[model samples]
Target: MKSGEGRVCQNPWLNQGHTVEFSPDGKRLLVGSSGFDAVFEFDTDSGEVVWEWFAWDHGFDRSKLGHYVVRSEAKCKALEAMGHEVLLVDDPGKYEFGIPTRQKPAHLNSASYDSEGRILVTLFHQGAGYVVDRKTGDAQEVISGLINPHKLSRRKRGGYFISDTRRGKLIFIDENYRRTSEIALAGTPGIERSPQLSEYLQNTTELREELFACIDIHRSSLWLIDVKRRSYRGIKFPVEWSVHDVASLGRQHGLRIRGLVGTQFGKVAAFARQLKIIHHFSVDGCEVTALVLDSQDRQRQLDV
Candidate 1:
């Protein structure tokens, strides 16, 4: 609970962390690790497991008429090696499990709470989105035909905007889980609500009351714009920490791993309201280290 310099709470159980999300209650980080083939909750304070669930173990492979079952050649071989005749398609790219993208998704990309209270998550290396029953941990695929979808945030009025970086558009999902509309995006892959941004730049007549944007997290650079006015600027991080980490990073940065940035969760203090920059790092042979740099200074390391 201290700030000034960031902190570190190592949890080795997290492997191939595809998606890192802070719980809505803001207590634990819900990590989707493809290596573990499950999404697990870890303590924000002690880095201990709260609970976890594998997608395959939780209805990810349910028999649905419109849904296609996809498995990698390696997985099919692994299952066959285990004495199961797992037939797989010759071209996995066109399958539900595999999109037209380069990387094959295996776990999840991002998560958010839907109006119905279900935990909505986009599958890794896949073209589908799913919603999970919060209390039971059960899941069901809700949307399809998206090419490597990124962070999806619930809109204030209603529905949710799904950022499809690969496809260069945002698919709008209604409260009923239907793809109602779409928004065109160019270079940015991820987007998040910026309440503090609207408050800070109150004098900007072209800006709206509630701002949304894509950030270069490592440098803490923000691209604030007036989508309608066609006016924008590339500058320093938003002069506020409240909206720092609202949009969770997807499995592959910008729809690819090569250009990814940021060290997962940049603490904004416990619930991440306010945190300071720090200066330090440590590694013990084989443990994951989560690091964060202050948005303002960029050079100063924040809590680990």
Candidate 2:
């Protein structure tokens, strides 16, 4: 095995980089810090920090706001007793991963660039997403009440797709932050659970049993990243099979799909979570341009 040599920046603030993105021209890199409520810009070739933006200093407060409270007394008591304020609880131990906590207000989960060269970023605990003007340092809200938005992908027509991990739903919101459509994840065999609700009142097991497990999406199809089953699947539109049908077929084929990426030719590349690679028959008919691995270990590609 061979390891490639890369320059390592030892800055304490950026030591635990949660996300890294390349600038439009690929001349600079944007690093999101998990340890600090800040974003850092570094010169790719020089490894020098050219700019730093702090979310906390910009009138952002995490402690004052509260997450959605489920209507159930038992769950509410449990969460309250633990001092967990987030509405979504995807993973109790990893509260940050499942939902945003008050301790990390500017905990940015995902980011993307809009068509007009603006930067869009999502804050986990804050229950809001923002679009920042590159030249003016102005920020505008995109959406709210998202159950811990995990990722955001730019759409073809100047909009964006957001993944609400705790809710197991994908919402397509336009540039103005108005939701267009939402799709839930379909459950796989042996892994049946509905998306979590903030109101404890809606936390019934039957409600949780509705699996619409899709987590990500491209322009044409939605990617079913069933974390529970550790598999990937694809959902195509226009007379495609329902989620239940796809899950049934997956059980018969012995295929557990985890991540999906649309190719240039409109096909999807499915990846198995356990395998940590693309499935044998997952190759789509599109051209491959760029490959990226997100914070959740899902693979993504950019193609025409």
Candidate 3:
């Protein structure tokens, strides 16, 4: 074994970095910083911010994010004056990874580069999505009236898909951001139980065609929603009692789940819920293998 340490880049403005996206050419990194209520684009090589957009500059309330947005540099300078090595705090207990407890307004969770040098963003607290011009940092509200919108991704065929989390629906919108169709994960087929209304849809990724792998919190399962057919199939993952996000790793890599809680594969699963597991499933939704990570191992896994 060998020990290693290195310094890459540091930027005090990027607080609570929720979701990251890379440019198509892999030159720039787009970051959605919820704490600062801003989205930023950083050069991959130099680690310098090339473009930035602040929600408060648009229509976001300044009261919710003014502290972080205004005093970020001063706070970092104060910490530096105190001889502190790191400006940003990377504590799991402080940040509450995999939990949606932070209640900052304009909590930008996801950011991605869209066509024609425009970027897409989803603000969970604001319940809206925006399309921003990369050059001018001008934002246009594309979709609104959502409840805790998660990921807004462009479909391969056409149009776009958004995970309206609190509403437990996978919403599809056209290029103009008009609501075309939506599939309610809670009301999806195979759910015979009465509507407990516990379904919280999280990260959604296009699997193939119209099928999408959606993270449903009800049974900690993946609800494969078919957009065209308006149908769904629930793949019950009992090992992990709380699944957070799901993604298709492609036809070669299959499907991967970013789960929050997990237990052993047995009847006493309820008793053992301390483990964090990452399950790899086949494209067909069958469990391929499970890797359980204990506390001593890696503390966090990147959301795929």
Error of 3 at 270 (Å): 15
In model 2, the number of clashes is 23
**In model 1, which regions exceed 4 Å deviation?**
1-13, 59-105, 114-117, 186-210, 215-304
Per candidate, the number of residue pairs that clash is 11, 23, 0
What TM-score should be assigned to candidate 2?
0.50
Comparing 2 and 3 on TM-score, the stronger one: 3
Q: C-alpha displacement of 175 in model 2, angstroms? A: 3.0
Error of 3 at 119 (Å): 0.8
lDDT of 1 by residue, 159-223 (tens): 66665645545566787778887545344433333423211111011113334564433223455
Q: How accurate is candidate 3 locally (lDDT)?
A: 0.65
Worst 10 residues of 2 by lDDT: 199-208
The true-versus-predicted C-alpha distance at residue 301 of model 2, in Å, is 42
User: Candidate 1, after superposition: displacement of residue 272 in Å?
Assistant: 42
Each model's RMSD to truth, in Å?
14.6, 16.2, 9.8
- Candidate 2 C-alpha lDDT tens digits along 213-245: 342222123454433355556545421111111
What are the TM-scores, per candidate, against the unseen true structure?
0.50, 0.50, 0.62
